[model samples]
Target: MSTRRYILDTNVLLQDPLAIYAFDENEVVIPAVVLEEVDSKKRNMDEIGRNARYVARLIDELREEGKLHLGVKLTNGGTFRVELNHRSFGKMKEHFLERTNDNRILAVALNMRIEEEEKQSGITVTLVSKDALLRVKADALGIHVEDFLSDRVVQYDRMYTGYKELSSESKQIDELFENKKLLIKDSPISNSYPNQFFILKDEVNPSRSALGMTSKDGNYLESFVSSEEPIWGIRARNVQQRMAFELLTRDDIPLVTLAGKAGTGKTLLSLAAGLYQTEDLQKYKKLLVARPVVPVGKDIGYLPGEKEEKLRPWMQPIFDNLEYLFNTKKPGELEQILAGMGSIQVEALTYIRGRSIPEQFIIIDEAQNLTKHEVKTILTRVGEGSKIVLMGDPKQIDHPYLDEYTNGLTYVTERLKHLSETGHVKLQKGERSGLAQMAADLL
Candidate 1:
């Protein structure tokens, strides 16, 4: 087999700082321009900045082993090098005239490709980048390119939906309802996961069905008991929502993940469950809601306000759901109510680090924008007694380096699907409104 060389782009390192060690036994090359880009972003306060600083520290540590310009031996038996000589425009000047960092990175890959071919080394040189446009340009330049795939948990279409439809006999459905728990051995379910929901349809008559969830031990199919009344003035309009409600209200499950498109009531359902548990059930001491401050389009830059005021714009979507839940009529009424209650708190995910959150119903909205590392950080902070609900639409990710398959929400859903303490649901229908559903479906 021929040895393969992977030239990583700056965005790849920013997306995953440990990307250099991901390719097993493959020569990893980093263009000097990528280091310059990382240096420029090292001062950022967000995740990207943290990654930039991490990458710098990693390279500095590797520098002690050997000269980076020549090559350094990686722990995985792979060679790592920082190419400093490929500064010429070379072939890229004929195509892209711009002298951008992307182009400079492309130039390094193109030069390597030429050198490999000329030497008849039988080695493959590929550019590993997360930027789609940069990948296209590399392809146009006759250089092989691929997206970083180590972080991806599963394909988007094959992502776990947290539930399954199994054909069962009417007797089994009746047994589940009568006893409130049917042993899986006697049922049609040959395989199951902890906390997995099921819609068991009768093989003879599909209309005869029952809703059940797998026990924590996966030994029995337990009946799903849904709330008969409204929760914080919110009712389950669909089966998925009902499933979400069941998971949200469960005191045994410590982690819940909900994935769906906009208008699917992911945020509203989570908020309603949090409020109900905090205020009505008194199961949790407080209800804390937070979301990443990722902008859809261009950022408005700095805003003039205090901490709470600065976070209002990013947390407005959460407030919108709170308003509906509280049924606040007049302006600023919801704020007053929240202040009077003192149990509900809304904040940004930025300050959630370094704090131990206990006895709280924590709802993380737009969780798809979070990276796996960030999600881990958040989950680790869930002190002794707390439930964290992470809800987001995988398709609507705003993170530049994240896709439906690689986002933190999907990562957790697939990785922890078999765990007893975690529960997940992928809401299929949008209960927001007809227009909202239509737009979510069409747009």
Candidate 2:
């Protein structure tokens, strides 16, 4: 079999610093222009910048083994090389931009493909990138292209919803309600997660149903734990919300992920649950809420104020939910409320790194904007006695290099769904308002 050569895009390496070793027994090539792009972003204060520096260090370390231009042996039995753009600008100007970084990267891939063709070698050269446009351009130029799929957890449509409905004997479901717990093996379900919620319907009577969750031991299916209790002056509006509340309020389950569309009350329910745990129950010492600083549209430049002031816009949605939770009557009163309480901290994901947070209810909003690496960094920062809730809509990702399936929220939910300490719920109905729901559905 002929070994395939993969030409990686800058975003691919920056997305995963260890991407160089992902392809086993295959050749890996990095365009010289990609290194320049990586260098320009090394000073960024976000995860991308951190990954850029890490990739630079990785490549530098690889250079020590041998000359990068000539190629070096990788631990995975692959060869790594930094290839220069050998094709003339005029050759690619017809199909791509004259001198853009993307086009230059394409030129390197094109050069590799042509060289292999001239030698009549049966080897395949494929361009690996996270950028959709780059892949499209490569297709137009007749170059093989693919996404870096190593980091993808699952397909978006097939992502775990954390809830399963099964038809069982009326006696079995009745046993669930009467006994409050049933052995998982007795049911038709084969696999069960630690906190996986279920809707058991009687096969004979479709109307007969019961709501249950996998026991903390992951062996038995049991009823919800105080599912009817109102959380922070808010009641669970639907079945999924009720399930989420059960998972959120449980002290044993330290990790929870909520995925749904906008206005499905993911953020509101998370904040309310955090308040219930931190303020009312005193399960945790404080509440720390954060979201990635990904913009929906073009950036509007820097804001004119201090750090807090600059963050007000990004954190306003959180404050809005807090105000609703506090039921503040006056405008700006939420600020005073938060100040007086002094237990809640709203910050950006950028500064959350390098800090050990213990005994806090950490809620990461818009978590879908994060990569798998970013999600790991955030989850690893949780100290002892801390519970972290990741809330996001898989369809609402704003990261350019991420998709619904590859985002951190989906990654964490799919990867950790089976753990006893982890729970997940995909909210279905939107509870914001009629107009908002209509817009969510129509537009």
Candidate 3:
């Protein structure tokens, strides 16, 4: 078999700084233009900037092995080269333009393909990029292309739903309800994971049903502790919501992840549970809420105000939920209430670093916009008696480099789904309103 060459784009490196090592034994090529773009992004104050710095450092260390311009051998038995030649502009058509960095990178791949053809080497030169437009352009220019697939955990369709439904006999359902616990070891259901929820239905009498969550031992199925009680006047409207409430109200499960579409009550339910645990039960000293400050549409220019005023627009939805829970009507009444309580705090995800929070109920909303590393940092900040809830809709990710499968919320859920101290529930039904549910389903 002939060797294959992979030309990586700038976005691929910024998305995964160690992407060069993921090509197996294939030869890796880094276009000089990609280096320029990455260098320009090193000063950014976001995750992309951090990844850019890491890539730069990695390349610099690789320089110690030998000159990068000339090829250096990687540990994986592949040659790595920094391509400095961009003289293949005549190979591409007119519409691609010659001055852009993307075109320059394309020129490098075109040159490699031309060289392979001239030498009769029978080598395949493919462009690996994360930009869909760049991949299309490469295909138009007759260059083979692929997206960076190293970071994608699973396809959206095959993602874990955190629950399952099983049909059983009426007697079995009654046993689960009466005894409150049943062993599922010899049951036909296979591969039952820990912390997974289930909806058991009676096959003989389809009307009889019960909800159960698998024990940490993955042996017994236990009924929910409390699903009938309301949290801060918010009752569980559906079975999924009741399951989520069971996990949220538990003191033993320190981490909980809720995922669903818009209008599924992910945020509202999490906030209600946090408030109840902190204010009513006195389980924690403070209720802290924070979310990533990702922009949906065009970002308004910097506003002039203090911390609360600057955060007002971004935190408005949270304040709205709090107002609904408190049933406050007058303007500024919610603020006055929060101030008098002196236990609730709302801040941005940017200000949460370098702080140790103990005895607090922390809610990180819109967490699907965070990176895996950012999520790890947030989870590590959980001090002695703190409980952190991560809730987000994977389909509504706003981060430029994240998708449904690669977001931090999905990453955390997949990694910690089987842990004894963690619980997860994927809400299926949207209970906001008829119109909202229709829009969420259709739009």
Leading candidate by TM-score: 3
Query: Each prediction's Cα RMSD?
Result: 2.3, 2.6, 2.1
Candidate 1 Cα misplacement greater than 4 A, ranges: 186-190, 295-302
lDDT of 1 by residue, 46-148 (tens): 7788899999999999999999999998998888999999678867788988999999999999988999999999999999999999998899999999999
Write the candidate numbers in order of decreasing TM-score. 3, 1, 2
- lDDT value, candidate 1, whole model: 0.88
The pairs that clash in candidate 3 are none
- TM-score for each prediction? 0.94, 0.92, 0.95
As for TM-score, the candidate ahead, 2 or 3, is 3
lDDT of each: 0.88, 0.86, 0.87
- How close to the true structure is residue 206 of candidate 3, measured as C-alpha lDDT? 76
lDDT, candidate 3, at 8 = 95
> Any runs in candidate 2 off by more than 4 Å, and if so which?
295-302
Better of 2 and 3 by lDDT: 3
The number of the candidate with the highest lDDT is: 1
lDDT by residue (1-443, candidate 2, tens digit) is: 33699999999988888998999989999989999999998987666888899999999999899999989999888999998647566568777666889988888888788888999888899999999988999988889999899878885478899899988888878788889988887545547777888898889989989999887666788886586877778898899999988888888989999989999988888898888888888989999998777652123247797888888888889988888888889987998988999999999887787699999999999998887877888899999999999998888877877788888899999999878889999999989999999999999
Q: Please give me the total number of clashing residue pairs in predicted model 2.
A: 0
